[model samples]
Target: MPICTATLALGSVSGSLLFSNTDIASSNLHSSSVSSLLSPVSNFSKHSQRYCCSSRRTPWVCSANKVTSNTEINGQTSPVLQDSSVPPTEAVRQARRSADWEAARSYRDSGFICEGRIEGFNGGGLLVRFHSLVGFLPFPQLSPSHFCKEPTKSLQEIAKGLTGSLISVKVIQAHEESRKLIFSEKEAEWSKFSGKIKVGDILEARVGSVEDYGAFVHLRFPDGLYHLTGLVHVSEVSWDLVQDVRDVLTEGDEVKVKIISIHREKSRITLSIRQLEEDPLLETLEKVIPQDGSVGSDSESISDASNIEPLPGLETILEELLQEDGIIDVRICRQGFEKRVVSQDLQLWLSNAPPINQNFTLLARAGRQVQEIQLTTSLDQEGIKKALQRVLERVP
Candidate 1:
């Protein structure tokens, strides 16, 4: 029989190995063909700094037949190893995993796209065979193409149809200490089109899904297909207050959104639907308040003389606050808050929430620079907690 003549080297000795493709299963070690394993090993060795057998099961090492410790090849003899000199199984596994982590880190740093096959999935996400070690592809990291309009389709139902499918993904995170590898298909898609788009660019989008916090929208590319996804936060859903995000947008809703911000490194896009339209609050009160950088016209200025308005209610409160040190602007956003018993006040603050009645996020200016901005409320901290709880309850 003709012997298989694929190559392997030990130190200075370089010669053809006796083992072949069929040798692992066969009683005879050198009788089978070795050509099948040659290509993969050759490709791997070209890039790796160190050479060793494949980091997989390594069945050949455990095979019944063993090569003699003393073998001469091309007039160069390799050093003979004693029985105790072999590396431990756990040590070899750790080394292999360490190398894989480093390789994954490099891929993340370089934004390289990798193809992995879905082996299976669990509640957490899809498990992919990323080269040698298994990697995780979280549901949130999935591309919009994987989602369908069917509301009945659960996460498991969506992922169930994707098993054995090959997917292009990027290594979003690789932590050696935690031994975690997080992959993202959306990031892979982002790398392709992020350069073509930018912040403030209006784009057509189709809503992928709706949650209380925001709606996920897929940005349509020039080719008329959704390529990237961005989140339209609830506050950005409309010019008016958004009680619930689902009230404004839903799955498959076709809309045009303005890109408010783009995070290229993190592969995130912040979109705004309200920005496409004028802010109703600002528009309704435009004559009352001046635009950002321009001073108000004398005729429309709120502070302009108005025969003294012949009115002076609670002028003492304003007079006392304005008299305080470094208190330049004392504009009141809202007034005439309804008074109620402490119990009723607590209930309404919890139910209607965010303590909208209270003054929040106002800064006092000193000279030309602004000073401390405070977030205080008429109700205590528990009211804030209840308000947040109510908000989170509406999130999908």
Candidate 2:
């Protein structure tokens, strides 16, 4: 039996072969024929030795010491050999797996994580982690009640607790590779709000700041400090001319307001404070005395003789009118008249009196010099007297 290690090319086998030491001399084959048959094997051994030992390398090689043998089948001789070598396939697979694992570890090591604490806050937003990675928590994101007209003292008090507390966060965004980190305590709070709060909820808030244009407020809510500030536009603050907002509302005032809108993605909360109070203008107009100066018989208009032209003694009339009405420190300007009235009401009176059109100017002496006022509207005599009386009463 011949032990066969075959290199198959399609359906046929070829290559060198080896055999054990067994020999039989055949009567039909001459010695020369045997020598000729072995000659090819000898030459094959020399070629194989040169191929294996040569500096020009290949993937496989055969050692020379092994004896070569030959067998005949179908008039063709096949060479057999003892030793051959080729690289194993398993080494390549192991290398690829190692490379993949290393890449994954490298990615994990390079990822970013942030940690800080909340600090101070303002009407516009919260100021946190000052002097060490300060972050802003906008009013809406701070809490679900962030949209209240005014944030409560409790919310602010909770914000106070945020200071110096360690907060773990991630670097969700970066700007031009800068060290600046945009953080949100409110972002974390939003999930809780979505679960708890619904549309059309009423909340209490505190006035944070009042501007000529509007007012800012903070709202109290769970999850974080939230604000529900909005504009109490000069028009909305009062129907009367609002020369300044500070005159109406100041910081830290408590107010009840309603939520008009909540934009969770944009993190905005709209609130209204004026809705809580009665319209001041309507109240004033309803209470105002008419120009004719008749108030249910108790109030009466001045006599017609009071309107007539008079003698030099009329100066006394003017003096009596001033004394009885108690008008003082009168100043007139192009638009109207300004005067201090000495009365219980202590009101400041401004009016455009007779012979005054939009272009008409007036001059009046309060104490020393005459001041000028251009009239903006025609005045009603009864209304003027009544207004003067009101002012005089109000003056200290």
Candidate 3:
């Protein structure tokens, strides 16, 4: 029997010793013989093999065992090394740490979600263990629920409460050489909810915050989880124009909203409160205006118009139209609004005064730029006059 030599090398990482065995077999060594003699490490492609280790309980057993032997020119047999009783040294541990960071980067760039156990806490965030590598999840990146609720509790106490919990996270930043591994639990939370959402889905939501342009709604799904968030533009608050979102929705207000758009990659959800409500103009047209093109007497129509509230800027524009053109014919058109037939000059004003669209716009009023005004109502001559007065009184 031809004998092969096996060499056991010892290395240290942070005072811990590791053993690696290199085995060189004879040129004619059988493949089965090698498998029977050496246990297999993790099977990774050449590039990945350095960073990923075997699933074995011991860390010392490595990919080196999988190396195939090369034949010598003189037909000399090489020694087969089976490492045994080697403890992981400081250097080996550092290398593993480097490997862990590399693994984190791979997961992040590939948009892979990882599940990890919360090990402990640091000043910046909680320490999360992804397999053998430990990653950092900053407190800000944590789910909103993780913040310390008790005023008396310190941040360390809050972190301690989360220790030992299993959490799902996405790699946000990963630097192997610099030993930086950052994860985001909040992103992971949204990712889990993203799959269940669709456009036109109605959901119960609470106003999280109100901005000038729109309001952020914390959506409650069918599962009763309030993890998803959506935005409701001011235009979507009501059928009538909205000058302030605060007037329509206060913080914590419960509202039914329809999902209008969804941008999953951007983690954005657009919602509409008006979609869940009947358009006031449509309602009035159905009840007040008969199918025979009759709206009762002119006085009755005036009374109906008086009951309807026009949008802020609409009254001013309509009052100007009414003053110039007497006895205006106000009729609801098929486009969900009454057609206003003003003089050609007034038509230019309608086109240039302000645009009525989904977004807000700044308008020059009294030689100063004023906040956006949305006109979203169908109204009679009387209603227009009243709304105009209100708009004029508020303008600077």
Candidate 4:
């Protein structure tokens, strides 16, 4: 059975009577239409909310699918066996709920975008007024199209202004049993803008929101409207290890990002911030060490180090490598050592090195700023020459 509520609350009708003369005369309810008094029902939620502020009417009749407390001057409000006035069986509830969800699912499966008003907001996200059932627009599901209106304003302020305004959204989820109906404005925008660009294309974007895993950036199309939002994973945020994304990205920061990947079906975009610059991990090592992992003869080999004077100790070798242009510090260490070298220089402590056949590390700054390069080998009484016999020969 369909869920319908058609109530006729007769203010002037006589008690225990369908219609009476004395009451109708005093309240002036005689002018009310009699035909609506028999009609079953129409819409429910939107009309049920209309509460009569003042008194004056022929008859309060709600001809909607649901019973409304307030109705216009039509005997339609009569308690004519409406759905709410009587308890419904499980089959009835399931039937109506299923009908509502079927319509919701149609919107989702068809990719039908529609205008919905923001009824209110809560901690989780915006509450959209969608007929009798309120659909939820989760904060994560909101797109740049929705937030770009006031890019710099706090979320609360923007939601306040959106309370009654309509926004274009599509149904992303509609599950009848769990009572979940979700909407996404972002997904709707993606269908419109995803075709305009492709992978490897560079675009200017604003950081809309930052989370522990990554930052969501709103891509600014050439037309100036933010049409799509993409994710910038924390690992792609920089060449340096990022412990916290907030340390580098904040909401509303303008940045240029490269599209590393795109998934059209999922409407996802992977972006990178570090790929814009050259990787300098090997800049400081190329001149000093055999890249092929071989010890070459003094002439055919380390040509860059041929002019170097033989060093007496590890500290001496440090002085020589530091002579390279823009080389700030040199460190040689075995792996699994202190990760920090840019902030503090412990190079002067090289005098504490143990002598002979011990696996040691030699670090050199070859114009790569303060980045550490690890070179592992044995060190003997002959000093650091044992570690760098290929690049710096023993002094006779």
Please, what is the TM-score per model?
0.50, 0.33, 0.52, 0.51
Candidate 4 local distance difference test against the native: 0.54
Off by over 4 Å in 1: 1-105, 148-152, 174-179, 208-213, 281-396
The best-first sequence of candidates by lDDT reads 1, 4, 3, 2
Candidate 4 residues 1-396, lDDT tens each?
Answer: 122221222232222122334333443322444432223211112221221111112234334566423222232322222343333322232333345466678787888776666766656667664443456776766777657767667777877778777777788877665556678888777776788889899998899779998998888889888888889998778755465899999888999999999999888899988777553333323332435544322112232332343222445655554554433445433212122333332221112234233433344332112212332233342344323332243321
Most accurate candidate by TM-score: 3
Can you write out model 2's per-residue Cα lDDT over 215-307, one digit (the tens) per residue?
A: 776665553445233434544454333457788878777767666667776655666655566654223212232234323222122223223
RMSD of each: 13.9, 29.4, 15.2, 15.3
lDDT of each: 0.54, 0.38, 0.52, 0.54
lDDT of 3 by residue, 1-396 (tens): 111121112221111111122221322335653344344322222231122222222333444544333323224333222333322332233344444555667777777677777766656567666654555677756664443124256668888888777777888877554445577877887877778888989887777769998998877766655767778988678765566789878876778989999998888899999888765433443433433545422113322333344434444554544443332332212111223321222110011222233221211122111112233444442354345446445543
Which consecutive 10 residues in model 2 have the weakest lDDT in total? Answer: 48-57
lDDT (Cα, tens digit) per residue for candidate 1, span 90-192: 2343344455666678788887887777765666577666654666787878877556344368889988888777788888777655445678888888877
How do these models rank on TM-score, best leading?
A: 3, 4, 1, 2
* Candidate 1 global Cα RMSD: 13.9
Worst 10 residues of 1 by lDDT: 344-353
